[model samples]
Target: MIQVVLLGSGNVATHLYQAFQKTSEVEVIQVFTRNQSLDFPSTIQVHSYNQLIPADVYIISVTDLAIAEVSKSIPFENQLVVHTSGTSALDVLDTKNRRGVFYPLQTFSKVKKVDFSEIPLCLETEFEEDYAIIEKMALSISKVVQSVSSDQRKALHVAAVFSCNFVNHLYQIGSEICEENNIPFSILFPLIKETAAKIETLTPIEAQTGPAIRRDEKTISKHLDFLQDKNQKEIYQLLTQSIQNVKKL
Candidate 1:
């Protein structure tokens, strides 16, 4: 079994710490947290950096801004250290010679239980031995483990932000529009789900349906008139133009 130390207690840390503990292949020896909001299993020891104990490997799960400094604070030189971040490069852990990245490409929330089986693991390393060890650990938690270079990982992060984060913002706007028209927002739930479900079998362009796709100026004008908020109206016009561009491609 691999003996590991976990750093941070935020969304990514909470989810990964719990998931790694479930498997017999890894033993999480220590969990570090700045705030004591969470409770670790009795088998594990929790600490702040001053109280931190050395382990075979230190898994840094803190925010992007803190990963570098936190890794520097830990007093381990020979021990391998890996940080979990989608956008941050492997060099962020450069405070230690034995450094790598074990980024899980999935959004994590503290209250939500993430399914590690489906989450893709993006691993990168500066050392050969460290790379092999992380590949094994990542494969233990997920079936999809790819040795993505920093450049490839950067591109994936950008794509993910546009695909997931931006789309969620669009959902927020849709909810607001529904509220303004005195329509129950829940009424859009089915359509939202169906839009996602269809993408599994159909390309987004194939699934596209709207006045914009058909380039019906009359319907597009009607939608523009229906939107009351300036922001919503701008968004609708921009998205419609984007859809039209996609169709032309």
Candidate 2:
């Protein structure tokens, strides 16, 4: 079994801990978190760095800003230490130990349980020899894995923000528009699902539709006029121009 020590108690850490529990190939020997109150068993949870025990791998699933501080706190050296960040470079970990990244390319939420096997695990290590250990640990919990460089991972993270975070914000705007028009937000579910499904077979550019794609100025103007929210009008105009610009490319 691959002995693992997980650090942090946030969504990523909690979900990783849960996923590791289900697999027989990996075991979480301990969890180090400053938070005194957590759902994890008290027996295996440590509040201080000094209490951290020996493990084959230590995974730091903290925020990007906190990653460096956490890595610096690890008392032991030369152990395989990995962080679960998509945007952060591998060098962010303290040089006192072997550094690596085990970034899962998915948004995590404590309330919504995710299927671990479906999430893509992006692995990177400063030392080639440490790669195999993280890869093994990743494979134990996920069916999809990729060896991603820090640069490639950084680019992927930006694309994800555009694809996921920005798209979700657009959905929120759509929901508000629907609510204002006395339309049920649930009515848009099928459209939303179909838009997502199309991208599987068609490129986003190919899947594009609407007045913006058609360059229908009249319809675009109508939308801008109908939107009372200044922010919504700005967003609509910006996206319309973006779509048209992409077409020109």
Best by lDDT: 2
Ten contiguous residues with the weakest lDDT in model 2: 33-42
Q: Residue by residue across 20-42, what tens digits does model 2's lDDT show?
A: 99999899999988876465888
Estimate, for each residue in 134-218, the C-alpha lDDT of model 1 and write its tens digit: 8878878888889988888989999999889999999899888888889998998999999999999999888888788888899
The superposed Cα distance between candidate 2 and the true structure at residue 201, in angstroms, equals: 0.7
What is the Å distance of residue 64 in model 1 from its true position?
1.2
lDDT of each: 0.83, 0.93
Best by TM-score: 2
Clashes in predicted model 1 = 0
Q: State, as a TM-score between 0 and 1, how close model 2 is to the true structure.
A: 0.97
Off by over 4 Å in 1: 42-45
